[model samples]
Target: MDQVVTQKPHELLAETLSTKMAAVNTLIQTRMASEHAPRIPEVTAHLVNAGGKRLRPMLTLAAAKLCGYAGEDDVKLAATVEFIHTATLLHDDVVDESGQRRGRPTANLLWDNKSSVLVGDYLFSRSFQLMVETGSLQVLDILANASATIAEGEVLQMTAASDLKTDESIYLQVVRGKTAALFSAATQVGGVIAEASDTQVQALYDYGDALGIAFQIADDLLDYQGDAKTTGKNVGDDFRERKLTLPVIKAVAQATDEERAFWTRTIEKGRQEDGDLEQALALMAKYQTLEATRADALVWAAKAKDALNVLPETAIRTMLVDLADYVVARLH
Candidate 1:
């Protein structure tokens, strides 16, 4: 119901979140600063120092604390989430050939793709080590599966690119794989570590999955609709890349034969030029791709809220729901 993007004076809970997330931060710095292979410290620090929201780790810590967890395991678990997220970002930049991240030159751009890839692997290994320290076999099992799902999702996305045949189903699967799997595991693992019951754990898992999906869909929507300056990325980056995102996928399904031909030639065949972006945006508008994408994001957000019905009501729980809403609200 509430918009996520429009931040009111009293709305942001970052201050409330920082206290709980402090341990998550500590875990990240200590684990990521390991002295191994010499190059590890240097390459890894590039990513570790670049400040992102740390949302994934904060979710883990907040979920654990809300569920009455008074133990130290939350810190390690939170760190694990950050490691997985950072690793994914490193690999994603490399895969996308992206030059910028968080308004700075990406690790791959600053160093080399090879270093980014290898450092990503190092983080992945350290993530597992953090999991081991948690001593929860279920935690390990959940995260191990998440890791596999994330890798599979990345490969799926790589193949899905530049193909106009990509449908909503395929696109959703890719987003779920590449994005939602880790979110699901991060929150669910927090519940598991807190010894929450199966029902609660399942609720958190669904919440994270739906939240991740909604968050990603919102991002795709912003590619066309967002302010490039605020988003810290180029407008129509997806379009210029000719990537088959949700908006493009929906547009293809609704296109006429002539429009379909244009899509096939320009997006699929690929040779993005000056006016290609304008043509792509016009096509998307003709087919209402932005609206369709927004609807999909709303559907997932509703699903995320529905999953929260199973969670016991608490300030943290309410904030998590609010946070989910805030994600989509940014698009408005």
Candidate 2:
């Protein structure tokens, strides 16, 4: 994918991150086999072996190393993070009834929903086992709370579906619970495992939370503005599904009486027709919700950088700051 900021990844940071990610990759390859059933292995490997950016695991590794950790548990934690992310992807595809992901057929689309869901469960259990191997109750608590938050976020989004009245406060909470919780926990636990000072620990947690928030907001905004080839999914998929995202919520608040009536009839009532796509695009542009959401993303990204002040300025910390900017810079 084309990164939108900082002239692609810096060479030094890319090499440093790459070395850490290699260890994570090895751990995943060695541990992600199925013991109970071979079919589980087949299904798990389909997505696990598929090329992903490995951002989550890299976050874990980067946080650990930046906090001066050089132990084997970090490897286990890195693998745990990747497993959790992959399991979420499986469950997400099932929930969204998605056909494509990362330019490939989704597991639920390639196989049946049964394979996707059950294999997702298997991965979840395996991730738990891997986390337990770390032997840190705090790590377990952090990830466990994150998993619950993620589920709550999904339920909130489902309940809020097609509701035109969903406000910015509710939207932020949903994005935080669904996306930022895991990112924060992954990085926070890395600091916890490294036994960083409380101040350092809080800084890492805040940094991850802000980074995740910015990233999700950017993702939602780019759904309308980005190239389909770059984003690896259909634009207007959120609109077609009648999901009320940040851009739509902001646009609704800014709509005129006639525009509000149109939204109520189409978006709220789920009465999309053949030309709904063009109509939604025009409405979004008319309200400038895209620009508003992007501003929110940049705000959180700046907060992410601010949180990094407690830590000494290392290359990794600088890289993390740059990466945070990259997430919000997508809209530009």
Candidate 3:
């Protein structure tokens, strides 16, 4: 009989950080509540309970503890980070017209798009309230800037997505804006609230920035390679939606005129038909873009691990290092 692996490092991190995470969870529940509008909590609860990894908020809490913080503000910051993330998900579903997330019906599918948008706005307001309680001007500035960057990234994607002209630089800008901005903010604010040294704070920011890049790249790669049951997403979902993620971007860069026409019709003109997805996958495989994209993700993961060298070593730090590895490990 084969022996079972008891837990992963993140599971252990969660166990070690259980007490603080409980406080963060309580704060999230309390803040997500709305006195006048019952619909706010209803929609919020649906998504909040959807079993995400809570990795962004966990980054905030882990950074604070790693920096030797013992105050209550880390909990508030963690909850605030979660609110910001949840708000983005709600808004993203509306934008994507997505029907499912975390293997369940998205809030927009269950409720009207207007309700999802309004509740997402309410959560953003709640996040601001929590940030003000932290009372750090720098922290507020970081989060505020991250929020703006996220919106900008989404808008950029709207214009650039499906356009073969979008190079890797534009793709990276969108990734940094949509994903890494919040991640960097989460870790940076944790160090700020802890009064960590400038070098340590910068190190945390770098770690998160690289980790977020790796994570999003892995996700994009998985769209072509992953099982729908495991990924909780339909394979070819990006293809069907005509979103030009990294692997497709690489394939596009090397396309023949014949291949380019296929992309133009399906992605640019949105006239997808039977075998389009299979043909698209064939182009990616022919270009070896999926392998190239995986290599890129591993590079960012390595960068994240390297960034951690600036911080003092601790159990939490080790777990964070492992967490970075695990983010890309999903690709294998």
Identify the leading candidate in terms of lDDT.
3
Whole-model Cα lDDT of every candidate shown, in order: 0.84, 0.84, 0.93
Please, what are the lDDT tens digits per residue for candidate 2 over residues 1-332?
24434244434454676766777777777676766677777777888877776777777877888899988787788788888888888888899898888888989998889999998888888889989998999999999898889888888987776788888999888988889988898889889899999999899999989998998999888888888988886898888888888988998898899888888888788887898878888998887888888898999999999999988789789888888877776688
Residue-level lDDT of model 1, residues 1-332, one tens digit each, is 36544653124455556765776776676777755576667777777777667778877877787678889888888889889888999999999999988788888988899989998998999999999998889999999999999999889888887887788888889999998998899889889999998999999999999999998999988988898888887888887777889888888898889888888887888865678788889988887889878888888988988898877788777788887877788877
Q: Model 2: what TM-score?
A: 0.94
Model 3 residue 86 lDDT score: 96
Deviation from native of the Cα of residue 199 in model 3, angstroms: 0.9
Give the Å error, residue 306, model 1. Answer: 1.5
Which residue pairs collide, candidate 2? none
Best candidate, TM-score:
3
| 276 Cα displacement, candidate 3 (Å) | 0.9
Worst 10 residues of 1 by lDDT: 4-13
TM-score of each: 0.94, 0.94, 0.98
Q: How accurate locally is residue 159 in candidate 3, as Cα lDDT from 0 to 100? A: 91
